[model samples]
Target: MSVTTTLRPPATNATAFVPSLGIALASAAAFGSSGPFAKSLLEAGWSPGAAVTARIGIAALVLLPVALVMLRGRWHLLRRNAGLLIAYGVVAVAAVQLAFFSAVQTLSVGVALLLEYLGVVLVVLWLWLRHGQRPRRWTVAGIALAVAGLVLVLDVLGGMRVDGVGVLWALGAAVGLAAYFVLSARDDTGLPPLVMATGGLVVGALALGVAGLVGVVPMTVTAADVDLAGLTLPWWVPVATLSLVAAAFAYASGVSATRPLGSKVAGFVGLTEVLFSLLFAWLLLGELPLPVQLLGGVLVVAGVVAVRYDELTAPREPDPAPSLTPEAPAPPR
Candidate 1:
C-alpha cells in the first residue's frame, strides 16, 4: 500500500471557491449544534459515552449506503487504509466527542468549544515540528495571541473557576481534534471523504459500544422530555437532530469542504462553529458568554486569521509525489 496518496489541492477558481466556502460554513453551523444538543441530553441523564455512541452509530447507518455506493467493489481500499480509518474513528469520532461532552457537563457550550478549538494551534505546532515547516512571524504572533485568549477564556485570575476535570477533558478533545485535521489532510490515500467518514463513524461507534459493555464509561439514556429554546420537546427530537444534521451532514460537508479548501483553511473555517455553539448554547441552554470571554473569543478568531493569512501568503514549493511506504495516518473534522 502507498504511504502517501495525491490529495486534492485547495481550490483557487471562482466557480469552486464560492460553493466550497458555503459548504464549509454550513458544516460549521451543523457541527456547532452538537454541543447544545448533547448538553440537553446530558441534562436529561444521558451519559456522554452513550450520547456520543448513539450519535456516531446513527450517522454511520445513515451514510452507509452512500459509502457502499462510492466503494463500487473497491473493497481493497478499506484494507489498504485500515490504519487511517481506525485512527479517525478512535480519535476524531469517539474520543473527541467523549471528551467534549464530558467537558460540557460542567463547562458552558461555548467555552468547551473554545477549548476544543485549541486544536487549530496544535495543528500548526504539529506541522512545524513533524514536517520541519517553521512558522513565519505572523504564525508565531498568532500562536501567542491564541494562548493569551485561552487564558482569558479559562479566567485563570478571576474568581470564576471552571471545573478542573472539565478543563482536562476539553484539552483531550483539543488533541483529538488536531488529529482529525492532520489525518484528513493526507490526500494520498485515494479514499473518498464519504468513505472515510462512514468507516470512522462505524468503527468509533463499535469501540464506544465495547466500552459501554465493559463499563469503562457509563452508558445511560432517558426517554424524558428535553428543554430547547425555552420549549419542552420529546427526547427523540434532539437525538434525531444530533444524529442526522449534526453528525451525518456535518461530517459529510466537512470532509467535502476540506477537499477543496485544504485542511489548514478548513480547520480555521471550523472556528466559526464556536460562535454558532455560543448562540445555540444561549438559546437552547441559557448559557450566555461572559463579556470578557466574548472578547477572548474575538482574539482567538483574530489569531486564526493571522495564521491563515501567513499560510496563504507564504511562498510555496512544489510537493513531491507521495511515497509507497507504510507510515502514520491523519483524520477529519
Candidate 2:
C-alpha cells in the first residue's frame, strides 16, 4: 500500500509551472517505455539482472555529480534519512525493475504491464481501507471495469500459456511500484528530487553489485555475454540509452514534475506513459498491441482518471500535515 510522491518545494511562477509540467510528461513517457526497452535488451541476450544493474548503476554514476553539486552541505540529510532512502532505492527502484524484467521473461510485455498497473487498484484500495475514505460507486465501478479489461487483455481464460513464477514476479513489481509512489509522497523539500534519486540509485547499484559478486546473479563482463544480436548498433547503445536517458533523466524529471503537480495528479497523468510505450513500440520494434490489450490500456487509464476525479470532485478528509518539516508543495496537474 506504499505510494511515493515526489517531494515538492513551495513556489509560484508561470515559468516553473510550464517547465515542470513538460518534464513530468516526458518522464512518464520514459518510464512507460522502460519495459519495452528492457525487453529489447533481454532479447538481445542481456540477463535480466545484468540489464537492471547496468540501468541503475550507470544512472547512479550520471546523477552522482549533479546530486553532489546541488546537495552540498546536505550530507546530514542523507545520513538522517538513510533508512528511508535505502528503502526507496532497493524496493522502489531496484526490486521493481528486477521483478519487471523477470516477468517479461515469461509474459508478453503488454500483459506484464497490464498486470503491473494493478498497483493503481492497490493504491485505491489502500486509500479506502486504511485511510477510511469511502470509495464512491463510480470509483468502484471503474475498478471493476479495469479488472475486466485486464482479463480481456491477458486472455487468461483463453489458454494463453504463462509462467506462474513470472506472474508472481509481476505481481511483486506492482507492489514495489505502488510503494514507490507512496514513498515519493513523503519526500521532503530539503531533499531535492535529483538528490533522492541519486541516493536511491547508488544504494540500488551497490546492492545489485554485491548480489552479482556473490554469484547470486552473474555480473560478468565477458564480451560474448554482452552481445547485441538483434540490434544493428553497438552492444552498449541500449545500455547507455537506458541508463542516462531512460533512468537518470526520467527519474530526475519525474521528481521535479512532482513539485508542481502534487502526488495524485502526477500519478494519474503519468498513466500517459503506457500510450507512449505503445507508440514507441509501433515505431521502433514494429510491435502492435492486440485488440484486447489496447482496450485494457484504455481501461487502465480510465481507472486512474476515476481516482483523480474522485479526489477532485469528492469532499476530501483533511490530510495530516506531513511530519517532515520544509515540505515542498507539489504542482497542480
TM-score of 2: 0.79
**RMSD of model 2, in Å?**
7.8
lDDT accuracy of residue 74 in candidate 1: 94
Global lDDT of each candidate:
0.79, 0.71
lDDT tens readout by residue for model 2, 1-333: 233343443224457656765787899888766655666667666677888899899999999998999978768887777887888888878888778877977987656776786776666665556555566866786677666666665555564557898899889988877666656655464788889788888988888888888887665332332323234665577788789878898877877776565544465556667767766776667767778768867886786556545545665459897797777889898
TM-score leader: 1
Task: Give, for candidate 1, the lowest lDDT window spanning 10 residues.
Answer: 1-10
Error of 1 at 289 (Å): 4.2
Best by lDDT: 1
- lDDT tens digits, residues 1-333, model 1? 223323455665668867987898899899988877887888899887888888889999999999999999899999989988888889888999888878877886546766788888787777667676677998888777776765565454564347889989999999989877777766677789888889888989999999899998798999999887788889888899999999999988888787777666677777777667766777777887778868767876787678667766787787998999988667655
